[model samples]
Target: MSELLEQFSAPPLIELESDLEALRKHAQKVLMQHGFPQRKTEAWKYTPIAALERRDWSSDGPDESAARTESIELPFDAHRIPVHNGQIDTSQLNEIDGLHIEPLRAEQIDTSAYVDHDPSDAFAWLNLARLEQGICIRVTHTLERPLALQFSSSDQFKQAAHPRIRIELAEGVEATLFEQHRLHGSGLINLVMDLQLAAGSSLQHLMQRQNDESALIARTEAQLEQAAHYQAYVLDLGGALTRQDLKVHLNESRARTRIHGVAALKDKQLVDYHTAIQHRVGPSHSEEDFRILADNHSMGVFNGRIHMLPGADDSHSDMNTANLLLSEHARINTKPELEIHAEEVTASHGATVGQLEEAARFYLRSRGLNDAEALALLKFGFAAAAFDALESEPLRQWFTDRLKQAL
Candidate 1:
């Protein structure tokens, strides 16, 4: 390595340096080679990674005490697995039928896993380096009910933790899962979830992030086989700065995917959601819907890409994004793309940035509500679209209330 490369490749923290030196060097080298994203990188134009690159992060292992105090609640009384500071709490784990949760093994590490994608993705490398322990969940044939995996961070300070998750759904299986993150710390939280859905399987993955005034970088990868159905919903409500990347591939025909997201920001927080979907086979469908509310100098970003392979004929996809700017200084950026190699496909995208509708506000005010009340009502209506799509009533109510309080 060159002098500059050698310098950047060295991690100052002794814990990380001692535990995973090779992985750390390899990860830092990738970041040094491809620095934080710039305008040239289409996928990262809206959410810059420069801030994350400058931070020096290290891990101190999992705190069993903090992990014990962390609690998470989902809409369903399903199997709960809590991961604190990147380590799963084995004591709190409960056994469930058709589901097996275990620690990730070294044999599972495959560097070629990201050969085709952006090698410099800092979080990806960071997770790879610090991923000491992770949960391996296998959903057997046709799950009896939904399952939930909760990752909670309670450490407060400059810290780093890598939590790796691998979910394998067998053929003909079906599951609705809530992958949640709760952080009370003020450091970097890097997570990577690798998922595989077998033929004729279906999965519903919902993500919620409720953290302190901390920064978070999260990435997820999913691979789907023939006739697989995958649906995702992401709700970002808390964090000083948060960014999530999703790479999904439909490797076989007749596969369908949908991504629905909602981001509510306040108090100078920044949130970004980027997604890429690739259809490698014929006749696949995908749809994306995103809603954002930014207030008090907060920022929100939405970037989505849909790719149709050369032989993927008769594919249909659409992306719709809407942003609500609650403060004058708040910013919202949306980028939607469609790359198609096939001649027969229906693809479209729509994006809009605006404030509350004066007409609606006026009508509500005239109907005897005060200005604040009217504005609150209008805002609630705007943010309710995504909540209505949720199958779990409690989760829907939880998000709705959080959104209202955020506004």
Candidate 2:
């Protein structure tokens, strides 16, 4: 531990050496197999994970001892499920009818690869190796109120956490899910959430992460059944470093999906969001909207891919990405891709890289608003459209307040 700490000087990776060897081996193997994605790689041209390989960072299991006593907030009147340092805090969980929360056993889940697009995803393999505990949430038919799951960590020296979330929403049922990430100290958090939505079911997911000088790595994979509806909202605040990978599969016709993201970064923090939505069947629809604000020397990266397979026709999809470069040194890279193997589809993408309009700012200032107030108003207005789509009212308000504080 001493030698590792001396070499890297980061509190999180220092503690990962002795936690679990199996996870380390798997992570290394996946890294070697997949290698570092570079500019040549179409999916990783804008944001490369090569730096991770050169850094010699270690990813061990999470230590439950380092978690702070305080818990993060949830969105609705919910049954809170807390995972502290990769260990489920069942004591705080409230038993609710029509819902089941339990540890996920290896036999209960299928570890087989679901998608063949990325066979050697080092991050996915890392999650498979270090997953100490899996939280299973079954939303039965009668469940109505939102379910909130919180992932918190305070271990600055701990290596990595592969916390898995398996959510099963039964047929004809509806539920809202809130996933929040909170880091008390600086550390690396590698987490994966797998969701299964049954036929005629609906699921709303809101993912939030607010890190103070920490590195967070997260991946979410979701499968939607026929006629299922999925809505997702992602908000990423500044961190020492961060990366989020999201993959959604519209496996059946008439499945509707929408993804919205907001990112605010400053200082030297780096944040990246990568999303892939695949329409394997015909008659599915998808829309994506993202807004990013980068200040100081921060960097924001976004890569979105929409795929329509052969024989999949009548699919309608649209994507728009808008970025705000708040400083001369701040940077943002936006990539929107559409791969259409079918011709009878309406698909389009648009991306913009610019700052707030000076004229708009001046007009706001002339209307009795100070420079700071005017900027805040404009920022709020820019993000308000997407924020209003949040299914939970309290969650939307909480994020709004956070955005105000951020500005």
Candidate 3:
């Protein structure tokens, strides 16, 4: 942990923003006090940071050649915000109606909730302490097109980059947020995102990520007001090392959220996802579904937790996770938890880890399909159920196509 602290020191990166100096100092203090998570850290025990500690980040700095100038190609039409090597190209930002984009100010960020002396949150604090690029995106009216955030890294990228972003939707606003990550090289991309949904607002969040040798650690925190709706769809194709923590708080009545995710891992890749949904008020709802397919020597982890607070009466939640181990050496760890404290509330959770059924595979093979095709079909059928509830046909098709390609 101390070695990681030394490697992640801020002095050698970029200078801290003057306006956020105090906050950065506070974050640094918290990290210094607790350091990074160790083997005993429950939340991070399955995901090791030893690979990060061994890297020499002394020569990791911004390089002019790392700038990406090509536009990201997407299957759908949308507004794009491109982040190259963890740096946003401000010059490419264009004006869009009903949307306002600006540099994130210190006032827009509050680290009080995550600045505690808990080593499990050390990465969250480290993001604040070493943040180099920050952006604030606000939606004032319903958007006709999805807002896409494309993040990619150059093959030469070997430096760690921390990027922070805040997204807010005004009352009655309806928008779609598309986040795509395609990273390469052996560096680290530690990202933090904050989301705010006002009353009567709706946000559909979609994410697709595929990486090579880079390591990605991302944390997203969302707060939903009265009658707000938030939905998330994720497709992770694995990487060298990946960890994501998503926490959503239903702060007011009638707030609801649904999360669906799939992690397809192969080779020596590893992916870990930790998601928590908090029903803080009455009449809130949440549903989560996650699937993982690990092949070769890959590993996958999924932890989904639902909490119904004391005053969250009439709230309901259902969480489920299904994982498949495709090889003898492949491993998967899945846990689904439900903690209910309120009366008149219903919550159910289930987790299962198993392999493909030989009967089903044999049946598919008997239907004129080869062994590889039958296996791929079986894997796709098991994993595609997570996205069955998606509302958009195009998005559903896109997800299915990507899943097929990944398989």
Candidate 4:
């Protein structure tokens, strides 16, 4: 508690100054009461950020209409929602059927009703405290095309900004989502995503974060109803300090979820990925697969756990993490765990960390490739397996291009 308390000199005083926002007020209260997560907190043990608790933490609020208009858009054509500097720009939003975008107004609804986030989670509390008209995305019906969420940031100060995103899928709705984080500058960005998938609904979300200068801490919470399916594919290639925490709740029977992510890091960058899936009812299942490529003096950490309650019989869960260290100084820490209280459940977990397979490199070299070319080919192939998990071919190509740039 003392270590986290030293990270901040004030308790979100900017949020306390605002009287118009109920969410901010509530979060301000939480911040004042709990402050931040300490080093003793097991969930945050691997991620101890020094900059986040700094006194200069501040945001410039929503971007102007001019800035949103002048900024460049993604190359591919899709239903795009651009959020720059923590402010959503709806000027060019695509009018997709069954999709609704609105401001998270203070007078509209209470934050507690829509969120399952932990109150003690420091960044989540900070995001709620400093949030300004964060976007609410809701899908009511089936959508043929994929939706793109473009989160961009431009801050070079010793400060930071918090962005809150909420996504709700109504019953029987099925949609594909694309989210990309394009960042510039050397500040901090805290983001929270709340996902609600109703009965018979399914969501396939693909995300990529490739910005080296900024420090990013992200959290995701997904709640799945009966027979609902949720799948996420994440690619992290950049950021000075990147940490992502993901939690999934299978509240009903036969719910299915899969979380697969790949991270390629270099230089002195650090990346931490954590996930927890709870099977609250019977016959639910989940699978998690992650791969990390570490080079230079970079570091990567992965921790995944699956929990099955007493009633969660007939469920199955599996997790596997594989890491390749490209440099002697690179480091990777991996932990995969499972807790099953049900007799009929099956669960397994494993992790592996080492250099590239010498046999594979030799095989590639024998096929008319030099040492450098063979290494490049092997690394590309290693990334391709996970990056190609997306159902969309164009999206995979777009991600491949970004990977090339980042790596």
> What is the TM-score of each predicted model, taking all chains together?
0.87, 0.85, 0.96, 0.86
- Model 1, 179: alpha-carbon shift in Å? 1.7
lDDT of 1: 0.75
The RMSD of every model to the true structure, in order and in angstroms, is 3.8, 4.9, 1.6, 3.9
Misplaced by over 4 Å in model 2 are 1-67, 105-120, 155-157, 391-395
* Candidate 4 ranges with C-alpha deviation above 4 Å: 1-22, 53-76, 105-120, 155-158, 397-407
The pairs that clash in candidate 3 are none
3 versus 4: better TM-score goes to: 3
Report the candidate with higher TM-score, 2 versus 4. Answer: 4
Write the residue-wise lDDT of candidate 1 on 1-407 in tens digits.
13323323334444433335566567666665664456566666656555654554454544556444756866667667776655566564456668777766655544555532453465577577555566678888666656667877665435666678889999989988888877766556677888889999999998888776556778888889999999998888857778898988888999889898888888878888888999888898898889988888888988888889898788888888888999999999887888999868999999888899889999998999999999888877887787677776877787787667765
Could you give me the TM-score of model 3 versus the true structure?
0.96
**Model 4 quality (TM-score):** 0.86
Q: After superposition, how far is residue 10 of candidate 2 from its true place, in Å?
A: 16
lDDT, candidate 3, residue 14? 60
**Global local distance difference test of model 3:** 0.89
For model 3, what is the alpha-carbon lDDT of residue 121? 88
Give candidate 3 regions above 4 Å deviation. 10-19, 62-71
User: Whose TM-score is greatest here?
Assistant: 3
What lDDT does the true structure give each of the candidates?
0.75, 0.73, 0.89, 0.76
Which candidate would rank higher by TM-score, 2 or 3? 3
Rank order (by lDDT, best first)? 3, 4, 1, 2
Q: Which whole-number lDDT from 0 to 100 does residue 239 have in model 4?
A: 71
Best by lDDT: 3
Query: Which 10 consecutive residues of model 1 have the lowest summed lDDT?
Result: 1-10
- Model 3, span 1-407: residue lDDT tens: 77788778845546656878877888888898999888888999888888898876767455757554545557788888887788876454467778888888999896766738579888999998887778998999898899888888877777788889899999999999999988887788999999999999999999999988888999999999999999999999999999999999999999999999999999999999999899999999999999999999999999898989999999989899999999999999998878888889988888899999999999998989999999999999999998999999988999999999989
